[model samples]
Target: MNKNNTNSDSSVKTVKRNKTRESLPPKKYQVLEQDWSINQDGVNIYGRLYLPQNLPGKKKAVILSHGLAGNYRDVTKYAQYLAGQGYVAYAFDYPGGAKNGCSTGVGQLNMSIFTEEQNLKTVLNAVRNRSDVDRYQVSLLGESQGGAVSAMLASKYPKEVKSLILLYPAFSITDYAQVAFKSINRVPDTLNLFGFTVGKNYFAKLFNYDLLKSATKYNGPVLIMHGTDDIIVPETYSEKANKKFKHSKLYIFKHAGHDFKGKYVTRANRLITDFLKKN
Candidate 1:
């Protein structure tokens, strides 16, 4: 049996073996903390919480979901900055998927986005049910495909989601599949095309789904941020959703690529801070 096919260690949730991120130094954020969990759904995930050193009386909270093949640290820096400005900001890594299954080769980025039911469930549980947390004021922020999951969640529970901030969200799964097909044509037909899967596309058994189509059903305040130079997800995806949403806010960072420009980091943080404050 493939080592990757074996079940996880059952004990730890999102067990990340490497602790040395020498390439990226921890940012100047106020406080960094993590709480790993094995949810009832049997998924291990990382609950990375960024708190303000000095607690604010009572403030809104934001839950962040990172991009494909990403962990909590992917977007925890943004959460830290938000916490610095007085918000309960949180993010997490998918259980088993990050450290164990991912290493074993049973992991797929595309599937992780849709399979994030456990991930989102854990996040909401921590915020709404936490003794010191506020339920009604919780918002969500997602990047890349995480944006797609967040959009679906916001639509699924419109009343619960006060607002959504999508950073270069994956608008269409088929778009990527189409591109992959074109690339795969290079290989001979004999090769096992679906031999192994590494993204949400392989799982979820997806044909096609548009993030904009999902967000249109959501009536909450929406903030869509994108970069003109983003070749990965493209800027049009964000623009399309902005056009459909009744209360959508769009921020285009010029000359920015797949990752957002550092210059607009503060601006993006401010926008989310203000949106969550809305009644």
Candidate 2:
């Protein structure tokens, strides 16, 4: 990205590549360059390590996963805030979402729900094994579909992820597809003519993800944020997800839409701050 129109590169890696814009509020934090790569499975993943000046101790990290079509900078604001609070926040762009600096390809996993899971695992592994900080204290924050995958990862590997902050995450892929179909042309019923039974295109993958089942299995604390007027992801879905969580809390933004901003953003940030501090 052109320096005039983008955020600066502050990762821990020695190599230079696509750089995500630093989050808003501009915390006095520097990004420890990153080592980017696409795994053998063709999942695109990259990590940006952030280090706080004069940190109290070896800083813990927050692995941030972006939304569909969004990049690592998508959550720069949150990452920056975490950094200000003395956490080494790492944000990586995942395959099937936005390709910041990782390999790319077309495959069943990339096109289906499987890509999200694969990318999440790859990113988490990358963060945990990094040389700069403590990985055991690592946590996750995901938006939209990323939220769903993160939830599944936390449930499947409770020993790895301590907690989760899901922002309007898609718990039901089928629900997302159904809402998507309303705006765009609906997929033809015969599209899955071949013995396959899933909806055509994205809908086909939605059937593969079962977030409710995953959440039920996750025994960690979950903070679910959703806008009451989120047309893309109805708030009701979050309501249902909240019930599935044994140790979870929900924050509804009245009159707020998909990506809640203004007050919603402020409160959500505070919530994360509290969760990380207490836990």
Candidate 3:
């Protein structure tokens, strides 16, 4: 019986082991910062580009816009984080977008949301021309007032923008104008609001502009993050925006204010990475 069992075991067909597949190591990325001067309609737009070094082939790109009275510095960390994740990240100072920034001043009278939109367009065009950028995978990320501009731009150029990320977007500019002016026909040429001198052109340009309607034009995926405790821009604005977007996700961080810091910023960064990867 032992001999018979041995014969049966020897007769059993031997299966060859599949070739051991070796997993490739994660790509090592080194963030290389480059200063860029983009010309938009003859206006000089200054920006910083965070390029992921050692990565081969064209990479996805993200353009980060700062909030009102903010410069590229406001979004520098975001740009660096995205670059570390194998993306080409750019953060630009809008022409006249901030009171004190690297870019040329547009003056308080000339500074408005419309002007900022133009600046964004210039940056977008410049980024698309880059040989290392995958134009088809370009994304826009904006904070506060910049968020409003990004939404408008995405809607205007839906085909160019693959995704949108808005951080506590201030969609209440028109509302604020209404409250300040009371009567549409009685707006002053220049007025001080929230410590910034705004011109009538700001109100005139946005008087009939419907943010919700414009946002719906872009059907691409959108990630809107707003803090429940935000006071500058109410969380409700983000909720309303989520409903307007065709493919949208909203995250409300408890106890987080309009500006994220510490753990809140870290959480936001992780969410951004996940969202970009999944989309």
Backbone atom clashes (below 3 Å) for every candidate: 10, 8, 0
Give the per-residue lDDT of model 1 (tens digit) for 123-151: 67667766546777778898876787788
- Which lDDT value does model 2 have at 190? 31
Model 2 C-alpha RMSD vs. true structure (Å) is 12.4
Index of the highest-lDDT prediction:
3
- CA RMSD per model (angstroms): 12.6, 12.4, 15.7
Cα-based TM-score, every candidate: 0.74, 0.74, 0.87
lDDT by residue (tens digit), candidate 3, 1-279:
433212121111111222453232233588999999887556888889999998999999999999987889999878888898899999988776675777874666678888888889888988988999998999999999999999989989999998998888988777777676765578888877666777777677666767656654577888888887898989887776776677777788777788776666666787788889877
TM-score of 3: 0.87
Off by over 4 Å in 1: 1-38, 56-58, 96-110, 178-204, 208-210
Point out the higher-scoring one by TM-score: 2 or 3: 3
Overall local distance difference test of candidate 3: 0.79
Candidate number achieving the greatest TM-score relative to the actual structure: 3
Question: All candidates' lDDT scores?
Answer: 0.63, 0.66, 0.79
For model 2, name the residue pairs that clash. Answer: 10-31, 11-32, 11-33, 12-32, 12-33, 13-33, 13-34, 23-76
